[model samples]
Structures are given as C-alpha cells and as structure tokens.
Target: MKKTIFTIACILSLNIFNSCSEDIIDLKPPYEEIIEDAIKSEEDVNKFLMGTYLKISSTSLYGSNFFFYGDLLGDTFFRSNKNFGGYTSLIMMNYDPINTGDINFYRSAYDVIQNANFVINNELTDSQLNKQYKAEARFLRAITYFNLLNYYAASPKSGLNQDIGVPIAVYPYNPDEKIARSSISDVYKLIVEDLNYAIENAKAETTSKIYITKTAAKLMLSRVYLTRQQNGDAQLAYNLTDDIINNSPSSFKLFTSTTKDAFKNYFSSSEDIVAENQPETIWELDMNVLNNPGVNSSLSVFYSRTGSKRGLLAKQTFYDSFGTSDVRRDLFSFTSIPVEDNPKGVWMAKHERAAQPGGNYTRNNKILRFSEAYLNRVEALYQLGKNTEALTNLNEFASLRNGSAYSGGNLLNDILSERNKEFFGEGQRFLDLKRYNLPINKGTNCPGNCDVPAGSKYFVFPFSEGQLIINPLAVQHPLW
Candidate 1:
C-alpha cells in the first residue's frame, strides 16, 4: 500500500515540476516564479499546501516519533521487557549512541519545518487565495517548531540559554549549505510572531475542522507559555481559548458515553467536538493515501512483524496506576504475545490501530486535541490557586468519561493524574514529567529492572549528535 502511494507521489512531483525543469536545468525555480506560475491558481495552491501537511504527518514527525520517542519512551507508558529493543535502547537506561532511527526522525521533523516555512514565506500573494489558508500554514509552522524546541533544546533557564535549537529555516536552503541551529529564545520568538500573524490574518477563510484555527493558535500559545513558565502569558492565552470554547457551549460537549465509546468517538465521530473543530482534534496532520506515503511508514513500522517488536503496551506502573474502577484502563490496553522474558499479560496501546489485518498502515495522525486544552486550563488554574474552579472544570471533563466527576485527592495531584489518563499514548507524559520535575523510573536491567531518579537530567532528551556536528554553535545537554 505504501509503495503504491509513494509511486503516485513521485509521479505527481514529476508532473508538478516537469514544465519548469524542461525550461530550466534545475528544478529549483525562484520563489517568485513558483508562486506566480504554480500557485496562482486556487487548486494549485491547495495541492501545493497539501505537501506541507504531508510533511507534518510524516512518520518522523507526528505519525510515530511523536508517540514512541516522545511519550512511550518515557516512564509512564512502557514496552514490556520482551519487546524492548529500539525503545529500551533509545529511552530506557541502555543509551545506544548510534541509533540511526533517532537521526531520521529529527531530519523528518526538520523537513516538515522547512516546507512550512517555504509556504509561509513565499506562497501567499494571490488576491483570490483565502487568508485562512495562509494562517493555517503558519499555525502548522509554529507547531512544528514548538515540538522541535521541546524535544531538542533545554528549558528557558537551563545554562544553555543562548544554545541553538533546530534551525529556523524560513526559506528553502541549498542542500550543500551547512545549517546552524538558532537560539532557543529566537526560535520561540519566531513561533510567537508566526502565530500572532496567523491569528490576525486568518479571518478571511474557513477550513475543515481538522485544520488549525484562531482558537487553536490561542491553545498552542497557552502551551508554549506554560512550558516557558511565563505564568501571566499562559493565563492570558488560556483565557482567550476558554472564551472561544465557552462562548458556544452547545457546540462543545464532553463525551459522556462509556469510556471505549468516548475514546473512539473522539477520533471517529464529530459529534463530541466543538461545532467548528474536528472531534478529538485541535490540530491534525492531514493525510490521504493518494498524496501521502512517507507519512504512512511509521504506521507500517510500528505494527510490522519484521520491525521493532516494541508494539504498544502499558508500563507495569502505568497499568497499575489505574484503579479497577477506572474505565480508561480497558480502553487503552490490549493483549499481545509476549516477545521475550515478559509474561503473557503483556499489553499494547489499543488507542491507535494495532494492525490492519495483514496490512500495516493506518490513516491520519492526530496532534492536538480539545481535551488537552481543557486539561491545560485546569492545570493552569490549579497552579494559579484557583483550586475550586480548576476542580470544577476537571470534574466536568472527568464526568464525561467516568460517568461521575472525579473524587480524588488535592486538586493539583488530581489534575496531574488526570493528565496521565487523558493523554496516555499521546506522547505527553514525558513532557508533563519534565515540566513538573518528576522522577523517571528506567525499568529493570538484566531481567529488566531500571529506575530514573526523579528530576534527573536524563529525563530531558539530548540534542541529536548530528545537530551538533552540523551546527558547531549548538550546545549539548549537561550530562550528554
């Protein structure tokens, strides 16, 4: 299936550049000419922008790395010992310095960033082109950078203050030119600038619910500010998103069905989503078999029998975290054959498609969800000492899935645990732990027993070695 898609993509690429290449030796046309000749038509612009979306949805970006490298690699979700290969090597105590997969993921993410930047910097001149499309593209660029910074760079206050993050390329770069990472602060500033521009200029168009919107920009800003510990800014951003959500209560209702139904509904149905939003999504990587193939490889590899055996499974601790009464446990776990020393009870993440019968791919990748926004608001409010309000909102979300509002401990702890349940398998647990300074347990050794100390520097992923090799100005993390 993937091969078929790749063939089609290559054909399309040939068709897209055939004219320019026939007239000029190199396919690299001036940005102006490409925009004037290739993108002047609405259909042409739409098709070209689809390529940008494909990059974000690619296996290296949201489709697989976002889940495996970002979330499952952390302590919360675990790949049972029997299936521990790439994940255990990359994330668990066994640090394999030569993992090429990590390098590939990084390159893929940067490619998406580059494509987005090209569209934003050069593609928006048509008087007839809707402004919303441009805004959506910009929103995607900001999102791509936000993920890169979080994964590749240290916190704002870390000694690597002036350290560079992945390069913030806004224009196409020559393949031969050595790219250098930009400072974390500079990257963030560019993200903010793009998001701000998107919010202001996006008023002229409307897009599918799966695409980013003005509200999605606000939600992302809220996340960015929270990550930087800029409380005031975080509060303001959340407030803006809250206003948008609250203004149309009828449009956004929590899923109050059975946990399985609730979880499935978020992805398969649109009823639970806000009227203008994609159900279960604040932003998603648009994908289709016809135009996207690289984005499908992650799915192929994840469920491939010949690939890494590290299929989804709850860490023993994560599985134990859920009480028997908690329905989410049932929703996420699945029985899978034990790969090695691990027992038969080994579980895999059931949230995503396990495997397509004999085939290995699945459609589309989900990035942000409205539920995350609700949690962000709840957590921010709890931190701000608005405990009562926070609990109220938290319970509102909980009630939808659990059949009753959560009755738990202190508001802060409850919110934290709720996040674990809400975002399980979504690649957020690791980030949440780092942000809150929590400890990571690196699982067992020989028989598989390891534990990472709480707040240890290892919790933070180091910048890729390739990044440093190319950008001498780049700073490595403390322990690396």
Candidate 2:
C-alpha cells in the first residue's frame, strides 16, 4: 500500500516539475530528476529543501491564492469588474464538484508534500546537519497537511462532520491499495507530532527569514494547538507563544512605538524584494526579481490599482472597521473622492512596490511574524480564563498600533476583531472565522450568498470530480 502511494506521489511530482519549471527557475536540477539520486549529499539535500520552498512560493499556493481565497471567501473584500474573472465562481460559491475553482492550489500543495516526503524518506550521512534537514522536511510536510485539512475537511470542533477528513499519505501505500480520508483527529495528531520534531531539531538561525527556523516552528505549533482546542492545548499554545514573545533569543519584537511610520516600516519597503532587516518578520517567501509570480498572479498586481489586472478592493464597511485615529487605517486610501464614486475602490497599501505599472511586481510574502504571536497568546489567555491578563496584553498590543484600548466587554470577540483589523490582506480572517464556528458576516457588499452560516457546506471546499475518480476510496465533501 505504501509503495503504491509513493509511486503515485513520484508520478505527480514529475508532472509538477515539468509544468512548474518556468515559474520556478531558481530551483536548479528539476526535483523529479534529482529523486533518482536519493539525496545523499549535503548540497543535494539543500537543493531539495529549496525546491520545496519554491513550490510553496508558487502563485497557486502561498504566493497569492492562499491569501486571496481567504479574504475573498470572507466579507473583507469584493471583486471589482477589473478582475480577470479567474475567481468569480469562488466569490459566488456557485461552482460544481467537477470544476472546483481551486484545483491548481490543491495540486501545488501535494507537490510540496511529495517533495518533503522524498527528503524525509532519504538519508544523508549521520551528521547533526542531516537531522536538522529532516526536521525541516517534517515541518514543511506538517504545515502542508494542516493547510489541506483546513480547506478540504471539517474542523475538529465541527462535531459530527469532523470524522470526514482528507487522505493521509505519510508513507507510501501499495499500488493496488485503496486511499481514504483520515479522521480530523488523526491528521491533527500528525501535524502536532511533526511540529514537535521541528521544534526539537530544526535550525535555530539562518541568513534570512525565508528559511525554516525553530522559532517559526514554535509559532506554527501554537496555531495548530489553538485550532485543535483539545484539553490543555490552550495552555500549551500560550506557553509556546509567550516564550517567543518574551524569552526567545531571536530579534523578534512587537512594534510598541506610537508613530505610524514605525508601523508602516514593519512591512518590507517597496524597493525590497527580500527583507532581512525587518525584525518582526519570522518567515517570508523570497520574491526577488530573479524569481517572482508575474504581474498576472502577483498579489501586488491583484490588490493595487497600478496593475492592469487589479480587482480586489477593500469593502467600505471593512475599511470603516478601523477607527479614524488607528494607524492601521493609514494603510488604506481611496482612489477617487466621495468614496462612493471610486471605481478602483479603497486600495490596500500593504503590498506596495517601487515599480512602474508594467515593471516587476515583486514583493516578499510574509508568512509568520511577531504580531501574530501576540494575537495567539492573547486568544490563548482568554481561553484559559485569564481575562484580566488577556485584556492587559490586548491593550498593550492595541496601543502600539495607535488604536483605542479595549474595555472589558466580550473578550473573544474583541480579540477576533483585532485579528480581522490587523490581518486584512495577509490572509487569516476566513480561517479564523471557520475554526471558531462563527457565521461569516458579508455585510452589504455581497454579490451572492449574503451570509454563510457556521456549519455550511461552503466552509469546507469540495474535491474535484477527477480527484474522487482517481482514488475510489476517497469521499467527496458532503453535499458537494
């Protein structure tokens, strides 16, 4: 059974290498060709790891769609007529099982997982460096699995439907063997186990924030723990985040200054393709001029009016969610006067670039940062019944962003509201809403379904009909 799945992964990886090579020119010696050599040397292992990063950085995955899909599914942004029509079906939520709108992203994720599996299943010399390499591989595989389950399966907190999860392929299965979705609990178990290994053995420091590090692993683990919400998991999550915020030896620090420039500077400068100087950045995908998602697929293009294909615009209600005095509000601006008459709508300055409209639209995609650590800790504290402590921390975080302090009201809602404000274009709102089982409030800008209920089928995306056909034991998402 294991061998069969392994063979299948290899075949898929070959197709990925051929089709994806043009976009990923930085990855030397195509991944599929290197697999036959068994990744024996240190250089080969590094190339393998870098190849996985390239896959993750693809436009179909984290480079754009992951963040775009999250915000589009939620109430924060609506598609304008300027869009290329690639995601109209996604926003309308009207696509069928045979033509799932996000098939490219699904395939890209599996390509990454397959690359990681190859690195983990092979061995280099018995050196400490090799252990770290394997640890990084596990971390990549775990995070990829978590993303799959988050999108394709019900949350563990979803109760009845939680048993219907995505397929597990940690080891190769026989060619003749059937494949089936693992339970939510089982997939979460793998995520936690792999992250624990990453925390114990991954590299502590590297030249840039693009590489996986122990701190990034800890931050990611806290997210997994918080999402699962099992017994004592909140406390565990809080501890991990707290340690990173207060005790970790790395240079990570929250922005405490009152100046808006300080807050704006936290994001990479427009001239920067890869920012090593940003202290808040824990992990970012390198989008240098040499390798970037082109203008058609770049976030800079989709979110800014300067680009030809600009379509995503901030909803007015969501824009108003930020108070007038809040520094975060400075990140947005109207392209026309009277707000209502603006055809381009409100532009989010988060993904700024120094280029002309037709120039390179490169910008580093930040995956993890210090701000998220504080948010995670605050939520964990609230869950642990430490209301006063959570409030204190929340206010401290808010004050730094030049925002009003939170008075004692509903703590969870306040925390979530802060997250919605802080992570608008960064791709977190929809998933946050889903894990908490909260209804998606589309406000008044919705073009299709106005309100998606807590347990709606739309919350969990469907597998394409081709996917189900290839694996007979695989179950299509319920009600798709």
Best prediction by TM-score: 2
Error of 2 at 17 (Å): 17
Global lDDT of each candidate: 0.57, 0.75
Error of 2 at 195 (Å): 0.8
Query: Per-residue lDDT tens digits of candidate 1, residues 1-480?
Result: 111001113113423321212222233523223334444444554554555666666566776677776555465545545544555555444442334344356666666665555456454554424465567678878888888777666656343434656576635444445656787778888888888877676542234544566666777777777676653765765675576567522433344456565455454332323212444455655433333443235543454223344455555666666666555655543445555535333343333333333443434556666677788888777657787888888888776566346665666568877887777666787777666655655453222335565544455556656666765554565556
| Candidate 2, superposed: residue stretches over 4 Å from native | 1-36, 170-178, 273-277, 336-344, 356-359
- Across 218-295, the per-residue lDDT of candidate 2 in tens digits comes to 999999998889999999999999899987655666656666665665553564533344677788887765457886
TM-scores vs. true structure, each candidate: 0.78, 0.89
Residue 233, model 2, lDDT: 96
Q: Ten consecutive residues with minimal summed lDDT in candidate 1? A: 1-10
